[model samples]
Target: MNVEHGVHDAPYFVPSPSRWPIVGAVALFFFALGAALTVNKVAAGWYSLAGGLAILFWMLFGWFGDVIRESQQQQYGQQVDWSLRWGMSWFIFSEVMFFAAFFGALFYARSIAIPELGGDTLTRQLLWPDSQAAWPGNSAPTSTSYTPMGALGIPAINTAILLTSGATLTWAHWGLVRGRRLQLICGLVATIYLAALFLALQAYEYHHGFLDLNLTLASGAYGATFYLLTGFHGLHVFVGTLMLCVMLARASQGHFSEKQHFGFEAAAWYWHFVDVVWLLLFVVVYWL
Candidate 1:
């Protein structure tokens, strides 16, 4: 049984012991600690956060490098492929649940908390006599006066950009499946450019919100929910763009074939997930 080579006769390829898992755990610990400290206004927290990010990136590069090498050596079998598929599926599902939790919070704030507080006569009289049961109420203690963000302008453009990126990503997938390397690379480049543009425009919109509209985290529930949803989605878009960049590099290196390209497919799945989430956010957060 040649474990290193992952002999075809073996039931499953089991890798030897590695330090990456513990390293990753340590990195996460620092990340969490740094985040907590930073939130409390500790200056040293920046250094800790930067260090943690460096360690995390190092672990990712090393760990993924090993997996890629193993894959290129044909160490993975059909069972391993299926395992990877299931693993990616579950990861995406967990992400879905994460976003669902935030959306649930938004629902609770809008449907139950706000209405109960404002609609009840005694509760309103005792608690917040000046507050109204509005969707974007300016009644919180820390609330700042601001104009609500609309569905037009940069948001509309960003929506189109994300939708177009999704199309370009699908085109890349088609090229990969057809064994058209040039087409695949071109499509990936277009998708990456679009993704970057979307992020840039989002950043600009955030700036506009904070500077011109006075929309901020302190601007009551509307601002909080707006940033929470859109901010996280933007992070996902940045991550997806990085993933697409990795796929582009792999494709350029002649890594994937017409049949075996789970890495590319995994990135595509993530990008599409980001796109769908943005659509939901556009409707729930901006339009309606």
Candidate 2:
């Protein structure tokens, strides 16, 4: 290796300062303000929220477009690639902690809070005489009437759908590794379809819960936990689907090669994390 060439490659690539960060901060300010106002029933909150979401999307597309162009131009060296992997790993870890907090809430509601409330004679006699230490119906301070979602129907089907998507994504990765463009594209298409189907089923399930079963966020602890877990997971699935769609577009354009495909791998990691969260939700929120 030439000494000068080696020295030149040693320095990592640094992108020039951009306006996207400030734009993102402004978007987040709108989001925060919008959320606060909306929670208090302010009318303008809707417009603010919409504007914030639009700005956020614009920032994401612009920033990601820049990165994609840089990657395509081969500006990202192995150092950048390794740093990206680490960044993605930390991102997934943060997501894990985020879900963990929700799960902790569920566990606390079920195992600790409900039981302590029901089991204490003085507390129950004075506060919630009718309350019982139950999983679904009477778990709250007052009796709540709503059908609890079960694991038998849509939940089970969604489980299988998400698991299958994981498999298809893996197959796509294998195809990319083997330099089979057709196989990769087909696998990604299948995965995207599966993900979309899962989202559709979940939406229908939510509709059924609200309309026919009278289940909602107002239905007390069960409803709150159910929607919080499943709704957030659905959002994750939606995001993962979008990421896969982008990957599919790039793959169609012959972007990723056999050796360099961290973008696809990052998306795959996130999708698998979503799948695992759904599995836990199925067992805990629906079945158990």
Candidate 3:
């Protein structure tokens, strides 16, 4: 544990040169390109997208495998651990900013654009003379029926599920710290189930919106923002659930220790962040 010691106790650990980063970049490029092309109705785009995802997943598996091996070998000391913590923190901060951009868009559209388009003063009278100034706004130039989503239904239930999952995740962390293997496993399993259930309910909500409610992206600005925010949050929940699954798998293999489980802590941080973002979304997008 000495800060200035040799290989076994070095404070810093530098990894060997990696091909994974370059590979990941390539995979991402293909994936983005494919997605764009698919959006434009290109037929071959699916193949490229699938291929890219496969490659990306393979790269992640290999990269994580190497890191896990190093972790098990105890190659990382306190300084290296600190570095990991800092790295994960910054990553989460970046994710926060990413969500902030979308939330800002929602705010701007609601507070400024909608008002300017609907107010009686100048622009609305001149441009959209027949439009109503509402949160969902006009469905389109053709005026399709629009029903705005409220916080009282599926959104409320999903919010509760996420909050509960956050609690379960915390309980699992406590179990990990206390070395109660059964408690930790049960907590993680419960969290994962909650996450999956939340996703299922969200999908059902989307189905209801599209079929019964007619809330499509093309429905109006409200539909766009609602889907944009909630859809991305659902994707985050999927990712967080996957991360928890990995953590649970590692826990089963006895990979984490009470003092040195940054992996679990990082996943927990991300899950909690997702939960908080959902709460905000529930208020702003669904309730407000």
Candidate 3 similarity to native, TM-score: 0.93
Clashes of 2: 0
- Candidate 3, 249: how far from true, in Å? 0.3
Candidate 1 lDDT by residue in tens digits, 29-118: 899889989999999888889989999999999999899988898877777898899999999999999999999989998998788777
Query: What stretches of model 2 exceed 4 Å from their correct place?
Result: 1-9
Full-model lDDT, candidate 3:
0.89
Clashing pairs in 1: none
Give each model's whole-structure lDDT.
0.90, 0.90, 0.89
CA deviation > 4 Å runs, candidate 3: 1-10, 139-143
Give the distance in Å from residue 29's predicted Cα in candidate 2 to where it truly belongs. Answer: 1.9
lDDT, model 2, position 251:
97
What's each prediction's TM-score? Answer: 0.93, 0.93, 0.93
